[model samples]
Target: MRAYERLLNYVKIHTASADDAECVPSTERQFDLARPLCDELKALGLTAEVDEHCYVRGWLPATPGREDAPCVAFIAHVDTVPDFPGEGVKPRVIENYDGGDLPLGESGRVLTVKAFPHLPKLARRTLIVSDGTTLLGADDKAGVAEVMTLLEELNEKKIPHGKVAVCFTPDEEVGRGTAFFDVLRLGADFGYTIDGGFEGEVVCENFNAAAATVSVEGFNVHPGEATGIMKNAALIAAEFAAALPADETPATTGGRKGFYHLTDLSGNVETATLRYILRDHDAGKLEEKKATFERLVASCNEKYGAGTVKVEIRDQYRNMKEKIDETPFVVDLALEATRECGVTPICDPIRGGTDGATLTRMGLPCPNLGTGGFGFHGPYEHITVEGMDAVVRILHAIVRRVSEMKK
Candidate 1:
């Protein structure tokens, strides 16, 4: 089957991961997609298995004379983001797009050319989009379908290629996709993550990410007698948020700029909580951002009481550029494959992190390849059938190139 057709089938499963769940996969629903993917890999004659943690791993041996070629791994994630409605996804296929404002279902949300200027460039292409109420799950599912289709093409066409490994990871949206990953077991010299946006985009750098949580403790008293005794935690939480640099936020920053994103906030008179994600391409700059959070918590504690406010911070992942730069050939191979597919490659730093970033740090030296997807993690998400076909062609090129390599 075609890659877009497989994407249509996979997005129907509710695979949104939980951010607060303490489990490895984060949610049980992730297995709903993982099991089917494992079965499909097995059907393709690859040795495949889904572990208890929901990681689907598959291996395909090289064809006859190509046994000496390097084993190349292709990776993608199964879980969608929890920030939006990922369940009940009803995809709408627009065969040969018109490059105009397209209405999505009856949800009154239009995918406008003004909001997404790239739409005009995609004229006459087959576009698949969501129904305006939920995310299209194209962020990484498009990658999954493209990889699956690549495997099918390799088998059917008798393509000459090296050993190939494919894995579908879970909970990537929640930043724990690689927590239980076994790099040595899959046994690849290097890998590429099919989790990037748009066609011909290759990501060698990503953000140095960290998550922070601020807790506020307040004393509650009756309103009539609360003037001197009551301390409002909710109000203090708001004050802390207001003190943050308005310009340094997700809405205000782009490109190589760093930002502090307030993801969740809830509070009452007695207790309050604020969750934030800090991101920067430079490790030193990311450290500065974390220190800013610490300073704010200290200032709040001084005014509200010594123990009224507290902050906890944890590092998520670092920029993969440092690690990827160590082995430059991995990125060059992807760029060469894209050009061979008749597409100009766009090498940019990802504003967000991917499983590739973590896997690269784990001595895998993996970079990211595009899935022909755009406007990820929200209702505006979309992909093109032609674009997916291009990615599959690129994957085929990569496999052939690997087969030709010496050792």
Candidate 2:
């Protein structure tokens, strides 16, 4: 099957992962997508295994003499983000985009360049986009399809590739993709997560992440004649948000700049809860950001009484660059692969954390590559056919280059 056809097949399976869940796969539906992938890999003459938790592992053994070459792996998540609807995704292909607004959904919503400034660069390309109602599931599905197609090509041509390890992970959107991952069992020297955006992009640095939950208790009273008798929880929550640096959010900051992002806020007069996602590339600066959050929480509690507010902070992941720098050849292999594929490699810092970031910290030396996709985690998500093909070519080239590397 063609790469686009493979992506469309995967998109038909709803694998949206949730953050607030406690399950291993997070959602049972993820297996629906993963099972078929395991079968596909096995049918392609590769060794494949589908775990009970929806973790799919597959391997293409190196050609007889190529086994001594360095083992390189490729990974992509099976689950789409819960931020958008993954069910009933009506993906349509626009043959030769005109760089104009393309109407989506029955509600008359359109994918317009005026709204997404990056659309023009995709003009003249065959774009697979959603119908404005549901997400296209291109985030990592594109990556999955690209890898699968590359594997199929390598097998058919009987390419002399080093052992290629592949995995389809679950709950990446929920920040626990690598929680149950057994890296030692997979046994790859290094890997690449084909899970980011922008073709030709390589991400080796990502944010050190943390999550904070602030709970507030308020005295609910009758509004009339209440005077100073009532303390509003909602007001306190708003005050806490106001105290954060406005310019540090994802919208305002780019590159290595850190941010305190308030992801969710809810509750009323009697009780309120605010969730903040903290991020910074520098460990010290990341701690400083957390300290700032704690200090604000303390100040709020001191002003509102000891029992009025409660704050809980949890560390998520740390910077992977420190570990990645130890294996500089991994970066060179990717750059060399990009050049071989006739694309200029774009190496940049990741503003958001990824499974690769955590895996690298876990001693796998994994870096992130692009999915040839854009507008991820939303209904506007899309991937170009040309882009997917480019990624497949890049992957094939990267494997050959790594095989040629001096051990």
Candidate 3:
């Protein structure tokens, strides 16, 4: 099957990971993609395994004389974001896209150039998308299919390559993809996540990320007895949310700007809770953002009563660029590979995290490459035939160059 066909097939498998599973892979259904991918890798003549953690790992041994070459990896996550509709993902391919407002299947929602603005760049390319009822699952499914295609082509053309490793991880959308990843077992010197971004965009730096939960405890009283004697927990929770600057939010922020995103909220007159995600490229600023939220909570406690508001903040991931800067060779090599495929690489800092953020901190030094998929985590997600094909060409070039470098 072609790469796009593989994408359409795998997306229909319902691999949306759970956010509250508390397990390694976060969801049992992720195995839907993991097991088959493992078997397919073996079918492609590579040594592959599906560990208990729901990670699919495969290894292609180096050519006879390139034993000294370093092992490189291509990583992709299997789970679609849980925030969107994922089941029965029906993909439609618009061949020779005319660069206009492409209508998604009868949803009255149009993929407009005015909204996305980047839509025109995909003119004449085969744009692939869902029927508007569900997400296309192209966020990382595109990455998965591309890697599989690369392996298939390498075996078909008898390309001489080094110890090339491929890993399809689960629960990356829920931030646990690499938690149980056996980096030493995969044995990659460095790697790339074909996860996000527009075409030609290479993401090296990402947000210093954290998740925070704020809880408010309020005294409840009967309507007749409630004047000032009652403190509504929901009102206190809203106050805590309002304490953070509205300007410093995901909707208001853009390139390199930090934001405090309120992901969820739930509460009643007696108790309420708020869940937020903090993001910033600068580590120092990221901490400041978290600290600012804490201060707001403290002020709310002072008003409501001590211990009335409680806050718990946890680190999710850090900027991968810190480690990548120490090992620039991998980034340079990938850039050269992109050039070889006749595309210029655009280095852009990701506003969010990837599996690379976790792996790089684990000493793997992984960066992110574009999968030609855009509008992630929602029904607006789409990819193009020509765009995915370009990335495959770039992968082929990288392997050939790495093999040649061994000599």
Q: Which window of 10 residues has the lowest lDDT sum in candidate 2?
A: 99-108
Of models 1 and 2, which has the larger TM-score? 2
Q: Score candidate 2 by TM-score against the native.
A: 0.91
Tens digit of per-residue lDDT, candidate 3, span 219-290: 999979998799999999988888789899999999999999999999999999999999999999999988
Encode model 2's per-residue lDDT on 1-407: one tens digit a residue. Answer: 67888998889889999989998799999999899999999999889998987899998898877778888989999998998789998889989988778877674777878778888888899999888888899988999999999999998988888889999999988878998888987888999999989889999888899999999999989999669888899999999899998898989988789998898999899999999899999999989998897788889889988778888999988888989999988988888888888988898887878899888988788999998998898888888999899999999999898777645
TM-scores for the candidates: 0.89, 0.91, 0.90
Per-residue lDDT value at 332 in model 1: 98
Q: How many residue pairs clash in each candidate?
A: 0, 0, 0
* Model 2, residue 245: C-alpha shift (Å): 3.1
Which stretches of candidate 1 lie above 4 Å from their native place? 83-88, 217-243, 265-272, 296-305
Global Cα RMSD, each model = 2.8, 2.6, 2.6
lDDT computed for candidate 3: 0.88
Please, what's the RMSD in Å of model 3?
Answer: 2.6
Per-residue lDDT of model 1, residues 1-407, tens digit only: 99999999999999999999999899999999999999999999799999999999999989989988999999999999999999999999999899889999999999999999999999999999999999999978999999999999999989888899999999899888999989999899999999998779899999999999999999999989998889999999999999999999989999999999999999999999999999999999999999999899989988878989899999988999988999999999999999999999999888988789889999898999999999999999999999999999999989999998867
Error of 3 at 185 (Å): 1.1
